[model samples]
Target chain A: MKLDEFHLERIQSQWENIVDYNLSESGVEPLRLNELVPHNRLQREILETKLGYPQTNGSIPLRRNVSSLYEGATEDHVLVTNGGSEANMVSIWNMLHESDDRDEVVVELPNYMQIWGYSRAFGANVKSFWLTEGDGAWLPDIEGLKDMVSKKTNLIALCNPNNPTGATMKEEHLKAIAEIAEDCGAWILSDEIYRGAELVEQRTPTMWDYYDRVLVTSGLSKAYGLPGLRIGWIACKDEDKVRDLWSYSDYTSIAPSMLGDRLGQMALEPAMREFIEKRTKRILKENWAAMEKWLGENEDIMTCIPPEAAPVCLVKYSESIKSTELAESLIQEKSVLVAPGDHFLLPQTIRIGYGHDKKKLVKGLSLTADFLRGEE
Target chain B: MKLDEFHLERIQSQWENIVDYNLSESGVEPLRLNELVPHNRLQREILETKLGYPQTNGSIPLRRNVSSLYEGATEDHVLVTNGGSEANMVSIWNMLHESDDRDEVVVELPNYMQIWGYSRAFGANVKSFWLTEGDGAWLPDIEGLKDMVSKKTNLIALCNPNNPTGATMKEEHLKAIAEIAEDCGAWILSDEIYRGAELVEQRTPTMWDYYDRVLVTSGLSKAYGLPGLRIGWIACKDEDKVRDLWSYSDYTSIAPSMLGDRLGQMALEPAMREFIEKRTKRILKENWAAMEKWLGENEDIMTCIPPEAAPVCLVKYSESIKSTELAESLIQEKSVLVAPGDHFLLPQTIRIGYGHDKKKLVKGLSLTADFLRGEE
Candidate 1:
């Protein structure tokens, strides 16, 4: 199948290393082995074992731990993937078949490009369901979402707390979304990669908790700071879906990396997870405040509603400048990188990633301000 | 996007753990960290760092080293994949765009199910080119293969030092195959995953060395005995194809595991690879003899040919018994496991793997003999 160019990855590959003050990333600084290993972890023992191809499904213990996170699920309901990327890819590729072209996929816009991008590229009748600013917060238009799902709808795709926008969906909103899928007999594929990065005490409700047919995708890359491990999973209560993904997984990546699998199992240990969550919460609190203060000072130039969850929030700039142009100017002229909202299908915003090094985040924002002044 | 069940994986998943003596795998004994580390390798240092995402295209050094293995090719032509599995998947998925229904894929029979399964699953019109047993040996019908490829052919899929059968194509045969693809303007995807596992002094000829449009896929899984690392790559002199794979990489697994990347780079170090090759050679020589002797003892019941390259060979047995039933009974009664050739679309044959623990290999073969005796 011929595919369109992946816009976000193409842009990041260009700017990630070349630019100094980069902000395009969507996760916190990665965890050091020392931080994750408090002397009793899999650091030594796992490294010593025969690292043959990991269990094709996943390590049972790892799947067990992952299943424990979601209610009414077991290891039988989980299939570990290469990353959250594969988890999303398999869910779309396995569930949505372009039979007769009547199958529709309702995808939220101004979000991670992969979900909608894949649904559109592989011949799904994709309907872009927009998430608009509502009462000083970012939320999907429930009525619009409801309208998008019909008898022909095959899947409803979502990322929460959403990519780029850092928007958390309310339980009532998710229930409404689930009811639509239920009524239409469509599947719900919720990519909850940023689920654990919540700023509020109450966590973002997992989509599976609300929907019976939900396939929840998540990984250690976001809040766990283990993107290097490339460990992610697809969770559902349905045995058929799990087995279906297993077949697709065989054709795709086969299974997660064995070394990564060992690391993943260790990372999900209750103690390690608690420690990581606390550490992530601290980092997010510190960096998010710096970003807020930086935006407050440049109120005339930029507008950003504080993210209720996630490590990042979308920052809107003047409509006169294209986000790509601003982003290019930031990286090329000032060595500061920010994600152009154009790729996210929003033209005048930049995704500010404050989950990285605080000093780089401050400098990146400062350079963006300087670039804006020059644009005028 | 709905896929047929991956039958081999399904069968393996059921029997792999239940079996005590497993001869189903395709690689030599897996490496322990102690064997891989001689005080100079990456075992300790890589464990200390923050394992994040590796370079998306592959780590530069790793690509550079992989390129050095192929004459006239540079790092620009390499795209590291999750495993040989992903390498084959992406090459097929990226290059074969089912633009018109007439695009055909020519795949070798009595081979890894994935090679042809993926081609057929992705909507390509697949022609099964047979590899026949002639002169008491496995030989590809070159004339038949030539007939299969025409102007309409999109891909000629092959696994060199072939899976199950362990048949290595002669250099003349490879060039002739390449000429067919070159004549038809079709791409040749050569999965040379067993390239370095040759039992003879002359190594298997690489597909890219002969064909300009060939994608040669190999990994540390076989010769290097590091399947646990999950490091595999696609080597093509065609720069556009390399870049095309990079884009497909984004949609699939994104990148190899960072820890795997570091380990991959180390595994490719000239000294380390030489050491591994020597060690692998020693193991293969010793183990292959044991297998040959076992087959010699069971000569009346089973027929076999010596493998010129890989550590496994497909053994054809008496037609009265099905390989799957024989395999099931062997593993169930004696806890010995071997691959059923029915998954390869051939019955009355079992893929016998000799690259395992010597004692287990001896024990497994004895049990197989007992099972065969009881069958008679």
Candidate 2:
């Protein structure tokens, strides 16, 4: 029952109240009420029909819809979970048989807490390869990753368009990782929650496309802007892995919520898919532009590796102001909340999200800039 | 991952067809959905509003409403899950930390597959205490239970108004088991999904009332006739256990579905509570009466241990045919589906659920009796 300190939830519980601006979040700009489907009528009808036990795997229609997102995947390959978090947890728990003495897990550092947290929970030996800010961009060192591989390693977890850092691995880099994983005979789990938010024209290629050993995890919470709906899925090419994870998934969530699945299905429709792409393109373009202008205007106070895909970017403060202390001061002084980089093992950096309303993002950044300049 | 064969889903792929009854299930007769809640304009208004991420633990209103069902338990004690299945699984996995050297779990035979399935999945050394037909009433033998308990035992799971058998334990018997659990330092988890479906009483005494080491899990699926809602809860008296499980629960389900929570709250209202009680009482009383009449008329062909609560009973066929074969024949010949007791480790006993419409239950029993009597 004694959990490792690193596995504990590190996000301070107090600042949950900051409203209007939440730059700490990794998900894309969330859906407004009007954007959700059934639209109004469908939601009403579903609610009128008393919510009952949904299908154990997921509603068939929802599963079919999710399966359609991939080229050859079917409902059998898809397992709907509570959210991407559960999807990732179940996949890891099932793939990395925890009780086996030989089981070890490799996770990318400067990543979200979920991968390591669950890894530690299962009593696995988890090693992290640091993704440092080098050559003006954040990326994992190929040698560092190679050094972590071993015969005992059961899985390698990567978050593409990595959270906090917002750095993405190119297709060649992912294929290289896949080759290494195949050599080690380990499952490669790619958390693509932020997959659809690429700022550039080339979307990150899914690991599944390269290796049968890969499992792709994504959900509506991130790129689709529907975190509230709380629907996520895992697509695995291996039938045995699919069945193993499905069993674990049943224990976690007898099935995904029917309402969540329905809404998620609607969100994956051609129209919704195009809407999400457009939204991601619009938000990333505008917000990154705003960030560049803001940083340029106050060059002496802060610096960051510009985000290429996801909504978040990690910025280093000019002086030793302790990221946590500075984040708290920002929230208290200007009601602008950002995640401290210490939570992700990068103490000098702070994670700032750029996926809010244009006007609000501008106002918040200006206030943050003024505060950093000690003018507030 | 080399999972033990014990953890494998007991029913083969063919058994999945039995779940298809949901399409034709009559909510009025078996589940009594109508009396449970009356959808009004105000509730409809709430449904139309976009449901965001519900409280990760559960919605506050919904948790509070669920807490009101228990005497000493509060909202803090309740952890809402996807359904009774998740609640049971969370309790089992968190409580039973099976490692290489020490692992033991004792579960009731003739119980729901989920309880034992999850136990085995955790790689625990699982032992089953029988609820045999020879016992006449399907009660666990205290001496037999004591013989199975050991210092290494970490957990024991049971189903009240036991699934398939539908046997309800008296308060004193439950307390005795709790004492045994206390001596071994084992956590006792009771699945009480059919809590309000007692044939004669307004309410049944729960194991939670007898022991702090006990965790009581239930959901709105069965008695409330709202399985589609997929809302269930785990209430533990131990605060530390609650906290630990809450953390693990987070990895399982970030939160219950907001729509499920909202509808669950409405279903737990004072009016709805009374309505469900009345409906369940009527259905259980009438169904059992019809079943008793059928048993009396065909005493030479079959025998049953009359169920005290819930809507199911284990009926032993005098014919030499295995329960699985009989169940398959019934489904194929009559389009009447009933769960095979083989899933519960009872080979000759067929589980007959009286939760359907009175006429259907009567007709199904008649058909089953005719088939057993070689008159088909």
Candidate 3:
């Protein structure tokens, strides 16, 4: 479909390059090469290999690693994409069987725009299942989801831990979502890009385990902090579906770059996989603790939904100020970047990435706080 | 919009891994890192860099070099894609304005499938302007092209130093094509991925030099023999169109890998850019000479369109065997891989890549000649 502007990207592009505190980003502050690979080994190997088109799916080792993220999965079930964005695109692209009558695409609201945008672009009727923020927890509205699914539901899309609000769906909630889809013989697509970044030791239930017709997409962009790698995959999928998606891949990116394939494989290599995850977990813990402490002192001006997972969370401003105005002023006057709530159409909050450098997050919050206090 | 299979890829997947002689490939034998970069210097820098996401458009230097290939284009006129494949996707993507009556996409026959495949998938009617092989020249039938264009044409796509045929469209012919598009107010998309691979020192005029609405796509893949990098760009004369295509980039591949971007910039860097092109030209010349000699000795079995540019050429087998069957036997019995004409929908021909190692080209041609002669 011919689409005209991509608003979220246009807004993110403004700060992707210019800001010191890029809290507008969905992933953590990117890791250095040395962080993912030993300086003397994979780093040198990454530069030495023949750079040609990688396999249409992905490297065997990388896919095998991804398979370990789920049960009963194999390399044949995966198609590595450019990022979770492409993973998201191809999943809907292959699953979409559109007719005028039964065309409902159900997704959570205040979500990653790609889901609804792509579902709508792919010629589906979209309906939202939303989340509510209460007592520092952002929980999915179960009754709303139940109402959204039916015989008309062609697809049910979920992102957990969710973007913007940073909500994680537990096993019980995931089972309920799956049962609803099962009742109508509908497909479920779970975007678990933020799965590994949960603050506590609590694990999120993956769609791979939840539904037979489920498609799960995650990548190095988020928890692995290698957004630059542009490596992601779709899994718990049928073999024919993977092959079918690879065809659309021909008309899309063809394949991810070999260099990225190598780096992603390195990131997923058994020896260093947990090591890489630990680095992000460490950063998340430090930044989250610092932001929470800072938020406690500044409770008069703002409060957060306190993200349990993912790198970022939403902060609600007590001042009667538009989020867009505060966000613009923060970037313009203070050179700080925080996505305004209105960026996601939430008028009173801004999303802050607490997985950034502790100093940068604190300084960014301090400047934002000063701006809000002055407004008061 | 729902596509079932990618036949050529499915066939190649069977042989891309197992074959020793892969003439089915579209590009020259891919370059090793040492061939593209000085083993001592830029190699270290590529590995040492933070590998952060690259600039949304492309690196300044890479875009600058791409701009140089055109007459009056600049960095702002380009959008770097995953490869020529995505280069093709986005070009068709941003140009079409769909209506049943005026939605024709005109392309030359014996062309790469994506130009037509993606066009049809995106809801546009595809029309072909025929090409003829006569007196050792693969000429775009100019009169036929004239008949193909009308006011209803939305886009005309061409691959100069064409795929399969390796036909190079000259400046005069390119201008004539532009005049046709101009008469109809339609856009031109030139896939010049094989620009520097001319066998006889002849050059293909870029579409950027010919038409106002033309979008020209090329990359490190075909001509430079760096297909692994998956780096390609589209150049149009308009800046807003480039910006508009970049918006679609968010939903497509998002961006090329940071390593690919870095290596691309390194490939196009003033110090080493010419060295990389020189390496591919050297291989092309050497391999082309060997294939021409082999074909001379075996004219009884086959004839070729005699490609002027690009690394691969189509060989018309005199035998009555179906192209797919011959290609299948060559791969299965002889461990050789040549693209069947049926892959592009022509039965009595197979495309052989002459940009491989000189020994492999001679060997691959010899084995195919022996096989065809034996068939007779």
Best by DockQ: 1
lDDT of 3 by residue, B37-96 (tens): 767666666556675677766777778877877777788888898888888887776676
lDDT of 1 by residue, B1-376 (tens): 4566677777776667668888887899988765676563454565577867778878889999999989988999999998888898888877675345437888878788786777777677889688888887778888998887877888888888888888888888888888888888888888888888888788888888788878888888888898888888999988987988888888888888887887788788899889888888888899998998988988898898788888898888874788888887887788888988888888988998889899999998898888888842
Error of 3 at A340 (Å): 2.2
Predicted chain A of model 3: TM-score relative to the true chain A? 0.95
DockQ of each: 0.65, 0.34, 0.59
Instruction: After the best TM-score superposition of candidate 2, give how far the Cα of residue A291 lies from its true spot, in angstroms.
Output: 4.6
What 10-residue stretch in candidate 2 chain B is worst by lDDT?
Answer: B21-30
- Cα displacement (Å) at residue A295, model 1: 0.4
For candidate 1, give the lDDT. Answer: 0.83
Q: Go through the candidates in order and give each one's C-alpha lDDT.
A: 0.83, 0.73, 0.80
lDDT of 2 by residue, B1-376 (tens): 4544322132322243454331122122423223333456644455454545566677778988888877787888888887787798778777765333437888887776776766776667888786655456776777778889898887778888687677888787788899999998887888888888787564667888888878899988777767766788898877667767767666665667666777678789888778776877787787788989998998887888888778777777789998778777876776666667676677787777777667767787787777787776
lDDT over C-alpha atoms for residue A144 of model 3: 91
> Considering TM-score, which of the candidate structures 1 and 3 is the better prediction for this target?
1
In order of appearance, the predictions have TM-scores of: 0.97, 0.88, 0.96
The lowest-lDDT stretch of 10 consecutive residues in candidate 2 chain A is A5-14
Q: Among these predicted structures, which one has the highest lDDT?
A: 1
* Two-way DockQ contest, 2 vs 3, winner: 3
Q: Give the clashing residue pairs of candidate 2, or none.
A: A51-B228, A51-B229, A52-B227, A52-B228, A52-B229, A53-B227, A53-B228, A53-B229, B30-B355
Interface RMSD of each: 2.3, 4.3, 2.6
Model 3 residue A125 CA deviation (Å) reads: 1.4
